[model samples]
Target: MHMIENGNVAAALGVRRCRVNVIAAYPITPQTPLTERLSEYVEAGEMKAEYIPVESEHSALAVCIAASSAGSRVFTATSANGLLYMHEQVQWASGARLPIVMCVVNRAVGAPWNVWNDQQDSISQRDTGWIQIYCSDHQQIIDTVIKAYWIAEKVSIPIMVCYDGYILSHTYMPFDLPDQDKVDAFLPPFKPDYALNPDEPASLNTVTLPDVRVDVRGELAHGYMEIRYLLQEELRKTLAVAAEAEKRFGDIFGREGDPYLESYRTSDADYIAVGLGSLTYQLRVSVDALRKEGIKVGILGVRFYRPFPDEAVASALKGKKAVIVFEKALSYGYEGALASDLKSALYEHLAGTGALPAVQNYILGIGGREIHTDHLTQALRAAIQGSISKEPVWIGLKL
Candidate 1:
């Protein structure tokens, strides 16, 4: 069915279609409406699920952890400080290898008390051992949420289906909602290898020692470090799993998916603009405008952030002259994290032959500050013309 609705509702419809058994919902700006729609579905008896209204984002995720541990398909949503509040459980959920999916409506964290759009919140949680897939629009929001569940269950790792707050969450756009029967066929019932049950009465995730130990059955068990290694290995392998899942999704839904990143006109371009979420799509205008003046520029929108697609990135940007990265967040004392990561990938894979591209970082749109296409175009032009700097470029600064 074709429909025009906000991103939150699109996400909610995706969750409902997947038949999530439990939703740990707490209201937070931008993310609040997603849960609000879930509540409406549960209240109207249109959706069959347990909608647990919690007092805090921490408790909301805690409920999801418990429900997911017991082998229920679970979901939760939050923004900015709300996500920071769940930091402890966030690591625990990933470490425990629970297949829980969450929607993080990207927002700026505050010391000055701002509630606006930025990638800082989720990007800061990069080391928390979760698969973070960023969406660029409402259609991608709905489609990615559906695939995240399958990928999480396949890898025994948690996943975050993230999109920008207000930009996509509050805005309405037309998208094709997949048929319920098709979604059901694509996502089967999740059956965990282990689930909490009265009959089983097994204790999971207990305190562990640094060294390997023998269990009650006299078999050697993994130590703390060894367990962490397995988690890292599975996340790396999830790249292939995600690709296969998306392939199956395309076969059924008729929309081919970009497994790691989406490239727009980078085939013969010498300069490529890279970014995440909806802002990257907005930069498409800059690419076109610059092309009119004989500047061959393209856009590279990163989709899967974690388990960073270094190989695919290196492949696309191998012969480029300059790679300009526009980010909504930074590394505190240094340039944008995405820019740094991109340079590392290019250097590690292609530096020996001297084919490395000049990577530039530009930080903008912090705390929902307006980002103009002309500002983006000017930045690209400056970087392409060798008028760049060592420090990260801060676009739209009046001071």
Candidate 2:
């Protein structure tokens, strides 16, 4: 079915179609409408799930953690300060290996109190052990939520589906809605490897000594270091799981997206613009206009942030003359997180090739500031023509 909907509604519908068992959330801007729609679905009997209204984001994820521990499929949404408030629980959920999926409406964290589109909030939590997938539009938002559950369940890790607040979250678009039967066929019912069971009660997340210990059954049990290592190993599995999920989703829906990075016109281009989220869509427009004007420009959209697609990124950007990173979030004194990661990936890949592209980072749209195509075009032109310095360029800043 084809319908006109915004990112929030698209996400809610995706969760509903997945037949989520529990949804626990606290209301926050941009993200609120998503959960609000889920609540309405539960109320109207359209979705058979428990909608738990919590007082804070911490409590909201706590409810999801508890439900997921009991072998229930769960979901929630948060933004900005609300996400920060759940920081501790976010780590807990991933540490516990709960397959909980969440929608994060990307917003600027407040020191000055702004409620607009910014990627800093989510980018700040990049090391929280969750698989972060950024969406460029309503279609990707809907599709990613469904794939997130599949990937999370497969790897027994939490997934964060992020989209720019107000930009993708509130903006309306036309997208194809996948049939429930087809989705059911593509994704199997989640069967967790471990869960809280009364009949088979066992200690979970118990404190372990420094060394490995023997269990009652004379089996070796993992120590703290071992457990941490296992978590890292499982996270690595997400790379393959994400790729498989995208392939299957594409085979079923016919709208395939690259699991790690989406390359556009980069095959024969000399300069490439790199970024994530809805801003990438705008950057694509800039790329096209520049290409028409005889500038060999392209775009590389970073889709998966965690378990970064190092090899794919290196391959796509290997021969490019320059790669400009346009980001909404920055790492303060250094470049943006994505830019830093890209540089590292490029360096590692080009170690043997002995060739490298001039990488530049342009921090833009911070605190919900508007970034127009003209700004991107000029920056791309400057980078391509070697007019801009290697230092981070702060776009739209008042001199």
Candidate 3:
């Protein structure tokens, strides 16, 4: 049954129809709509799932850990402080290697208690052993929510589907709803390899000493590295598995999926702007206007953040005059995280091939501030004119 709704409702219905066995949720701003929708689904018998309305975000994630430990397909959603509240369990979910999929609306954590757009909370857990996927639009959010299950289960890790607080989360957009049969075919039932079965009862998330540890820590660290490696490797794979999944999605539902990154008029440009999430969509509009004015500027919308598509990024940016990286979060005392990673990607290539372009980092759009077209237009013009200096630059601010 297809319906017109916001991204949050669409996501809730997608997971509900996927037949999730356990849902642990505590409502928070921007993400409450999803859980609210899931509640209605359960109440109306549209979904057959156990919806646990928790007292707090911490308890929500705790419930997820318990359900997942019992080998149920568990899911949750939160934003900002809610994610921060579940901080401990975030690591627990990954350390235990539970394929729990979460939707974290990118909101700013605050001393002033602001519930608006920002990337800090989710990005703060980058090292928590979860595969993070960013969505540029509502369609990507719905599609990635399904893809996240396959990716997480295949690699046996958690996945966080992040979208800007207001941009995609609150904005209403028309998106394709894949047929249930196609989704069922594409995403195999999430049968975990390890679980707490009564026939074969086992301890989970146990503490251990450094030397006397049961290799859980060692295996966890290794599993994290391997999962990340495979996640990147899967992006490079050109076989039927990934492609067939995307093709089946397209054939049944008519939604297209790109392998890694999306390019916009970069074929003959000397400069490129790299960004992720909804900002990239706005940047595309800015690029088009600049191009019309005879400005040779283009954009590369980064879809995958954690794996860091170094080779793909290098190939697209190679021979370009300069590359400008726009990031929503700051690493604190360092440049933007994406900018640093982009430089590192180029550095690896530079070491092997001895060729790379001048790159600069621009930090912008944190704490729910506005990012206008002129901001990008001026930044790109400065980058093209060689007026921008310093390794780390802050964009659209008095500084």
Candidate 4:
């Protein structure tokens, strides 16, 4: 089925098709519409699930945590301060290893109180133990929601599906909605390995002593270090699981892109522009325009930020003269988060090759500031000509 819809509606429809058992949400800008749609689905008998309306974002995620521990497939959405408010619970859910899926409508965190598209809210929480998947458009939004549940349940790690607020969240686009039966076939019901059962009771997230101890069966029980180590290991496993999910989803739905890093015309290009989310779409247009003007430019879109796709990114950007990173969020005194990660990935993997590309970071669209192809084109041109300074460039800045 094909229909014209915004990203919020697309996400709701995807969750409904997944047969989610519980939805606990607190309404926040941009993200509110998604929860609203889900509520309508539940009320109209279109979806057989409980729509939990919580008073605050903290409670919303807390409800999801409780539901998920009880063997239910749970979901929720939030943006900006709402996400910040749920920071503690976010860590709790991942620490408990609940496969709870969340939609973070990327919005600018407040100081001057702006409510528009910015990736700061989600990027700030990158250290949390969740699989972060950034979507470029409405189609990816729906598809990623279904894929997230599959990946999360497979690895027992929570997943965060992020997209630009207002830019992708409210913008309308025509996307093909996969048939419910096909989605059902692609993604089976989530069966957790362990749950809160009265008959088969087990202690969860119990306090651990600093050192490991022997259990009743003479097996060593995990200490704090061991538990954290296992969490890191599980996060590493998500790289492979994400790839498999993308492959299987494509086989069933016929829509496919690189689940890690998507490269366009990067094979032989001298210059490349790299970024994540809806900004990648604008960068692609700029790449085309630059190519027509005889500039050897391409694009590398970072789809999966958590796993970082280090090896793949290094390979794609090996021979390029310069790789310019466009980002909407900055890491305060340091470079943009995505740019810093890319630099580290290249340095760690390509140090032996001695042919690392010159990398640059340009912060744009922060606090809902507008971005256009011309702005990106100018930045790419400067990067290619070696005119951009070593420090990060701020696009659309009045000063």
Name the top TM-score candidate.
Answer: 1
Which pairs of residues clash in candidate 1, taking residues 3 or more apart in a chain or in different chains? none
Q: Residue by residue across 1-399, what tens digits does model 2's lDDT show? A: 999999999999999889999999999997989999999999999999999989899999999999999999999999999999999999999989999999999999989899988899999999989999999989898899999999999888999999999999998999989999989988788888877899999887888999999998999998888878888888887888888998999898888878998788987899989999888889888899998998888899999999788888999988788999999998878889999999999999996685688898899998888898899888888888886565799999988
Model 3, 334-396: lDDT tens digits are 877788888888887765564677887888887877888899888888888886667677776
**Candidate 1 per-residue C-alpha lDDT over 1-399 given as tens digits, one digit per residue, 9 for 90 to 100:** 999999999999999999999999789898989999999999999888999989998899899999998989999999999999999999999999999999999999988778889999999998999999999999999999999999999999999999999999999999999999999999999999999999988788899998999998899999999999999999999999989998999999999957999999898899999999999899999999999998999999999999899999998899889999999999999989899889888988998877788888999999888999899999999999976679998998878
lDDT of each: 0.93, 0.91, 0.79, 0.91
Candidates ranked by lDDT: 1, 4, 2, 3
Worst 10 residues of 2 by lDDT: 382-391
| Clash count per candidate | 0, 0, 0, 0
Q: In terms of TM-score, how similar is model 2 to the real structure?
A: 0.98
The alpha-carbon lDDT assigned to residue 45 of candidate 4 equals: 95
lDDT (10s digit) by residue, model 4, range 334-380: 88999989989899888878779899899999999889779988999
Evaluation by TM-score, superior candidate among 2 and 3: 2
TM-score of 4: 0.98
Per-model C-alpha RMSD: 0.8, 1.1, 3.7, 1.1
Positional deviation of 374 in candidate 3, in angstroms?
1.5
Q: What C-alpha lDDT, on a 0 to 100 scale, does residue 164 get in candidate 2? A: 95
lDDT for position 328 in model 1: 95
